[model samples]
Target: MCKALSLLANSQNLFVNLARVAIFIVMIWIGGLKAFQYEADGIVPFVANSPFFSYFYKYEAPEYKNYKNPEGKVVAKNIEWNKLNHTYIFSYALGVVICLIGILTLLGIWFPKIGLVGGLLTAGMAIVTLSFLITTPEVYVPNLGGDGPTPNFGFPYLSGAGRLVIKDVIMFSAGLICASNCASRILSCCACKAK
Candidate 1:
């Protein structure tokens, strides 16, 4: 039993490290996408629907709607217009912020202090993303109970938005674990120095 427990405990660090690396990779990849034009366009729905983020799109809201056709084809001119708007500016800024978080988290590989801070920052971001499950309707699978495509309403029935945000829960836990581990190591190092 002791050997079994010991083996289980030893794998904890490996799993935690995997989670941390996963978050960093996701942040960098998603942020890099948001920095571009098409992705900037795609994120409009999410940003527009977000109460916390909607203010950024207030002035350009009409142009945003204008970009869409009945068939859902986005016209070129309005895409250009959106690219020039404050909404796009905010998105690009957000992208830069996400990329910075990933880079900082990566720095944790070399410095425990950096890791702790990065872990906390990533955890904060994960909390905010998870909030979307409540704030954004996109998270809920639409058309259920009334004989539509999606037969269920919540939880496992999540839409694309929900799937995206729900995955952040793991990141949140991972970040907390990373920070805790880093904190313990740092404190132990200090204790040794004092001794």
Candidate 2:
């Protein structure tokens, strides 16, 4: 048992590499989805309400609500509105950036310098995503009036969107870990050179 424990304890570098791979997988998958119509449409709520991103859209917050295109369902008018809003254009650009970050993070396994940038960028992206919890009303469950007022709605009550946004906390930490690991490697190399 102690032997196994020792092995595990000494495998921190392997684990960190694995984490980098995991981050790459997640970033690439999610970023690629941004190129799709449904995926682009899904982000409307977040982008429309975000002060950092709202300028990319021609319409306002509630205004986007009216033009929503449910996944897999095509609404011509909504598509037109999205095009006018430059929704797809923004998403495509965002996707490319995300994919690049993922590639850099993966390369960090061998090249610490590249990895450092990727890790920092990953954390930055996570921060922006987490901000949706505050800026996007869709993050919380709305009190959809039924026969009676909804009991579990609003702050402290997370809708699907809110749940997703909250998960970015994990990504934020992972990015920091990767960044720190790379920084350590870089410093060690510098120290060895000085000797």
Candidate 3:
């Protein structure tokens, strides 16, 4: 039992570091993608469906709901502006924030205070992304991808993007772990110096 516990304790730091690196990689990659117009177009549903985020767009709700994808359905200038906002104003902004969070969290590996701040920001973003589960019905697609039956309401299923959003929960946990470990180590070091 003692040996087993010791082994688990030894592995704890490894898992924490993995989680940290995962957060860093995810943020940097996603943030980089946000810089592209195509990636901006891709996140439309998640942003438009979100009550908190929908207001960011100048267009009305129906415009977004009716907007089609990849079939030459560009109807008006408003749509173009909407896409621009998604790319320039919203997605890019979010991307930068996420990248910053990841960078800060990763920095915690060397600088405890900086890492704690980053951990807090990462945790905050995780909370925001997780909020999409409640606001974005698009997260759940109909069985058969929207052609199953008459009035087939999709529920109890997470769409691909939704699953991606769901992964933030893990990141949130990791942020807490990073912060906790850093704080503990800092306190321990300070205590040893005092003695």
Candidate 4:
């Protein structure tokens, strides 16, 4: 019984280590992309076109156009645009913060506490963004004239907007995993000392 328990614990530790490593790699990649604007044409362009990216653009992108409300009786004005430099600085700062958190988490330097905080922030942002996208009626129709009327695609759940909504849910789950006890549970099993 003792030997079996020991073996199980070791296996759990190995799994946790692997997960941490994977998370680190992904974070580094994302952070680098945001910081350097590397490959903006490749993945960035595709993601920009994606429903998930649309939410980001709606709130953050100055070039995004505003649309009339569902009633079509009133035209919506564009939100005030911040200066390009200000927006870039804010975005870069956010990327740096996320990168730092990811690095600390991967190191297991702070374990549950920092991990929990980082995960919570990530999850919160995703949820809020998701909610905004879900509630908005306007769908982003790429390549259409910027000032043209909004397109009408029936069935809210079947539209491209739906894809963005679903993607946010998946992203939220990933954040939850980082915030939850799964990592700690595995660590405990391995007899690894928690930070």
Say which candidate scores most in lDDT.
Answer: 2
Q: Per-residue lDDT of 1-195 in model 1, one digit per residue for the tens? A: 999999989898777677668778988999998876667776665677666787877543434665642234667786666755565788789999998888777666667788899899999988878877777665788764677664687655788768877998888888888888778879989999999
Q: Estimate each model's TM-score.
A: 0.80, 0.96, 0.80, 0.48
- Candidate 4 lDDT over 1-195, as tens digits, reads 999989988786465555556656756766666553222222222333446544443243323323212221322231123222133344465567657756755655246666666556556656855764544443333443445485544445334645655565654665666666445655675686544
Sorted by lDDT (best first), the order is 2, 1, 3, 4
Candidate 1 residue-wise lDDT at 13: 71
Clashes of each: 0, 0, 0, 1
- List pairs with backbone clashes in candidate 4: 9-190
> Which stretches of model 2 miss by more than 4 angstroms?
146-150
Off by over 4 Å in 1: 1-5, 60-74, 144-156
Candidate no. 2 TM-score? 0.96
lDDT of candidates 1 onward, in order: 0.76, 0.94, 0.76, 0.50
Candidate whose TM-score is highest: 2
**In candidate 4, how many clashes are counted?**
1
In candidate 4, which residue ranges exceed 4 Å CA deviation? 1-19, 37-63, 66-85, 135-165, 182-195
Better of 3 and 4 by TM-score: 3
